[model samples]
Target chain A: MSEPIKTDVVIVGAGPIGLFAVFELGLLDMKCHLIDILDKIGGQCAELYPEKPIYDIPGIPFTSAQGLVDALLQQIKPFNPLYHLNEMVETVEKIGDPLFRVTTDQGKVFEAKIVVIAAGGGSFQPKRPPIPGIEAYEGKSVHYAVRKMESFRDKRVLVVGGGDSALDWTLNLAPIASHLTLLHRRSEFRAAPDSVNKMMALVGDGKIDLVVGQVTALSGGDGQISKAMVKTNDGSAFEIACDALLPFFGLTMKLGPVANWGFELKNNELIPVDSAAFETSIPGIFAIGDINWYPGKLKLILSGFHEAALMAQKAYRYVYPEKRLVFQYTTSSTSLQKKLGVAPERPAAPARAAT
Target chain B: MVQITFIDSRGTARTVEGEAGSTVMETAIKNGVPEIEAECGGACACSTCHVYIEEAWREKVGEPSPMEEDMLDFAYNVQPNSRLSCQIKVREDLDGLIVRTPDRQA
Candidate 1:
């Protein structure tokens, strides 16, 4: 057994909610150990489409996922959370009163007074289309998304899907790709109206080709996509020569290691939790963010914020039962008031005339 | 609509109704089935949505993409039938298909 490191709290995920827990815990002068499967923090906010605009989150009227992550990082910078990235918590078990043991995949063990499961959507896995002989061209020409846009420059690219990502990438690659073809299973796109209009304009000018069909096969040798075979909605098949095939299909959320913890799930879907406290059936273990389920539950970033804040208060109470949380108010005298641009003398209190 | 059956590792059978055009992950998620965690929202980034198809459904579900296969290498309890549920789409002919979620997600 590896030597166990101890801490006040062990947060299971490093996403926005987990980071908020860390920030709150730090405010209370508590130590926290944050763990995540990804190499970076910000959870889904950082991992998902960073460039895409997110209008749902509160405070910022409109911010990209990456922008939100950057702002969150700045807020937690002072706390200096102990981050353990590129690691996944394999198992969590209650050992004693208000104490738990967390073990990682690498055989590392950690003992903590409390465990906060801020693992949003757990570990995200992208969905891939079922295409024959596509496996042989795994690393060669097939791709899920182009993290590096420069890679496909001057290349003949075929972008698939009717979603926003598909349209976004298609538009982005239009100028770079020597020949660009956009294929969708449906005639109408699910992308934003503006993007669809722009794509349509490009198609009208003969800048790109739009094909409504499903990719059936990939033809190439020595590990690269040389040509793509697509079947139209109407029993028609056509082969398009291409250097790269990019699929921008959307994603789905899954429950990871927590599935074995034996928490009751409604309809075997989301993990059920206490509606008031957001605690799972297991004491000292809680689920937050999109992974949680309850009566009147709203799965949103704003809702996760409320859940995280309330859970932190309850967690604090669990860790320190005797200590009463206190909010200190700083009182300023005349001298301090002057520095703050406040008048030295207080205005006369409103006359207390008998009503 | 496509009818699919998911048998959890604990041997609980759950039959879910899925649209022919949606991915298996979406079908399972919509029906409140506790399997596949399409963490990346079906973007083929995370492996929390790992599942093993029944021998009969393996050919029907087909093979996962290279990126998905690489991610499965990082999943817990990987098996020959192991596949990311988000990668498999539901079709009319895929009714009665069976899949088993792993004991753990990540």
Candidate 2:
């Protein structure tokens, strides 16, 4: 609400689908700004499976998940869409007919004539370890993210998970914490070799305790944790007395705040959009990609691309109601070619899902 | 086709037929076994398709690759016999394979 950055279209996600939307909107002379929860773009492609090979992306025979995202970034370069990374969209409210006020958890706000919900699978959030009664201790003695290291001074800390985040924090907090313990389900670590060596040295020096186990339960009162019940692979249970517990269980996609935004949801998961314009019940708001649900809808990247193209056609009307809309293919239209920064005489190469 | 039985955490067992080349995760998804999320669609990027291979079929299923072992670190309640169903290929020798799904996927 603090003098929102005005834009023609504010896309709620910067995933592959959202990135593609920028291109379609740009072809129609509409500037767009995109936002994503992850620190980096590409959403699941970058976070979950960057190296995995992806097939069935139209003409492209094969490309890695990251490869497709790179291609998309290159294709949308002409549009030069601004991306607000490491931010989560928290609220969306309608201010005027076909106009919306969108705000992010990072306090950035945007006022746009068109709001596109291209958020696929909602947003990636920290995965909570399914330990019994862990909720009561959260934000008191248990923390997912460390905002400041000074808070852990002179406290018994238990760090869980074998990934980089777990190893990184364990090494950083060991010196400050009264007694630190690194608990993992297995001996082999997913962290870098150098960090593992440093961790082992700490154990050798008796600076930290490395327990090969999983947290089964938490015992605490008034949101202050006192002890944690851990179970080893051999089914033996032991108690780790700790004031603070940090469990790094990676991330999972959830329907997050978008579920609260005024709209219709199918099965409380996907936004329901009509197939023609891929617009939800709300006017001037459109949804594309896997986040959208329609009758006989296939959750494929290609399907999302098709949805983006059709949604742009309807979105142009909202951004420019007085101007007559003309449909032009990038393959043949000189104006579309100019927008693509290509030679008008030679036809602009059609945008493949991934080059 | 090979037959696979998926036993949920509640002990409800569902048996279904799977093609020889498809993955156990795919078979569960095709049959609507209700446990395999397969969030990454058999890319082995997520642990949602995690299942504990029964003791009887442990040897035939084999050990997880080092890459898979790294990914298992993200799964919940991982046991000695745990394996990502997406990595388990359905085959003639693995007919009547029984696997148990954990209470939740991480």
Native A-B contact fraction in model 1: 0.05
Q: List the residue pairs that clash in candidate 2.
A: none
Candidate 1 lDDT, tens digit per residue, B1-106?
Answer: 7788888879999998999888889988888888566666676566678889999888878887765665564455455678888888888889888998877774
**Candidate 1: segments with Cα more than 4 A from true spot:** A126-253, A327-355, B1-106
True lDDT of residue B56, candidate 1: 86
lDDT of 1 by residue, A1-355 (tens): 8999898899888887887777666666567899987768877777666766778887689988878778877876766778898778889989988899999887889999888888877765445666767778765688875768888999999998876788899999999999999987656675788999999999999999999777888888988888988887567898999999987655434567877767777766577888677888887877787778888888788888788777777777778888997643225444323333453667899889898
Chain A TM-score relative to the true structure, per candidate: 0.59, 0.94
Q: Give the CAPRI class of candidate 1.
A: incorrect
DockQ of each: 0.05, 0.79
Cα lDDT of model 2 by residue, A108-195, tens digit: 9999999999999989988888898888888888999898999999999999999999999999999999999999999999899999
**Once superposed on the true structure, which residue ranges of model 2 sit more than 4 Å away at CA?**
A344-355
For DockQ, the strongest prediction is: 2
